[model samples]
Target: MSLIDLSKHVALGIDIGGTNTKFGVVNHRGEVLEKGNLRTDEYEKVEDFIDALYEKVHPLIEKFGKEKNFDGIGVGAPNGNYYKGTIEQAPNLPWKGVVPFGEMMTAKFGMPCTVTNDANAAAFGEMLFGAARGMKDFIMITLGTGVGSGIVASGKLIYGHDGFAGELGHTIVKPGGRKHWSTGSEGSLEAYASATGIAITAKKMRAEFAESMLNQYPEEEINSKTVHECALKGDPIAIEVFRYTGQKLGEALANFVMFSSPEAILLFGGVIKAGDFILKPAKLHMERNLLPIFRNKVKLVFSELDEADAAILGASALVWEK
Candidate 1:
């Protein structure tokens, strides 16, 4: 059976992450009909990943084929480029070089397909169904394995000249400071603010406080979530790590605000799970660094959207916009 016709209703939203790929069929009313996740490591090659996704999605499309109509497929992926329709050198994905992502998905699904960076997708998702709803200008920051950002100016996603704008993570926070864990991008904010970055920072702090409860966990199993749990339990080291991370993030956002003057900066993803540990410090530093004119004018808020459903909603919103 064929997918829903464009002239009908709703759209398919696909969010491809480093660890999982999530997809859903959503209508104009922001209601999701069906949604699920697939492990990203199952596929060896890029083509294999595409095939696996279609295999999983095709059944859902057919199952809902007779009930609700899907207008198109919208995909949100790491390193995905909107203009080029490619996932170019994604750090987490095993795929090398540029993968013709949109073309391949379109061919497999026999429907209109649109692709954008996961950050951009998240920002649009917020605008369409989440925190930024009804807002004209804001920034959405995804604080996960890495820091990803989507900039909306004048109510439009800033694609930049090369369709790679709004890369807030790669913006230099510490000039000539350190190398990024994945991309080797020097002094990038991801080096210090991502989940991995937080873990790295935590590891350093753990070494200094050898008697802390954090030592109870095996090093291999440690993660940002674990750190948050430890901090909540009054682990000074963990708290310090979050404070430091948030401070750095705030400093970075302060610079971004100077350029964009956004109404709010929305935070999302796993690292943000640190909640006040991260937000408080970030707000403190952001306020300290901002100019008087911008101070107290811009707000920093958390994404009310569910992380699992956001990419799908964001991706679907991309097609819905078109």
Candidate 2:
């Protein structure tokens, strides 16, 4: 009988999102052994944030370390630079300026750490355990509070020269169009396609139709989830918001397909819960804008990973990376 070695297979994965931070212990097969989350907005100082994280995450590490060799830590955050292991002026994070996040983690946790853009980590996760497995080229787009993208070519996440490549969300799709809340960029894909953007769209469009279901909620209460709820009930205004958002997303995707000619484009995050309301239009517009040869070739699909788990899995996959 053959015995499986548990050592050298366990890792800690931390996903630092704008609103929350999620962490977990994972094995080599991308299974999350245990997980928890903390509010990212609660800490004004990065040090406090790290300390708080350590308090919660250390026990899991201790639990797993009893029998297995722990393989260090991996982190995914907005604007994280893999080459430098830093988070530079991430608009969504409370911390200002460049933060040596990797060094901080190593110092705090006594483990080697690797950090990369959150979207890039998602791509790695997809390659390692999700739909992109065995594929040489693909794109992963995360539509959360903001839009983010990770590009993989020849089975490698493209870090570019600065380790910040594949920011498709910030790419200008509509010059002088909607403005991004954080970057203040005009006409970017993120302005119209993100979950935040969808809510904004709903708020704006609802005013035009007095009888629209979206008008029921107070202005502050309107959000993507509420919009989705209205959309599910066949509210025309909510449905139109998604259609408009999808149109913009599809147009941007057409450009991406042309640039990389990837085999597929995988969409992830809370916005995906809208299902075909967003997917149908995105696929339609993407195909409509593409050249004949490029049309009908690129597969646009939702991620297979559980939304709550993908970030942790992605973060952990970085640990196993060569």
Winning candidate number (TM-score):
2
Model 2 lDDT tens row, 124-182:
88888898888889999999888999999998999999998989999999999988887
Q: After superposition, how far is residue 220 of candidate 2 from its true place, in Å?
A: 2.0
Name the lDDT of candidate 1.
0.87
TM-score of each: 0.93, 0.94
| Model 1, span 140-183: residue lDDT tens | 89898888999999899999988888888988888887788767
For model 1 the local lDDT of residue 171 reads 89
Candidate 1: residue pairs that collide: none
Where model 1 places Cα greater than 4 Å from the true spot, the runs are: 1-8
Best by lDDT: 2
Q: Model 1, 142: alpha-carbon shift in Å? A: 0.8
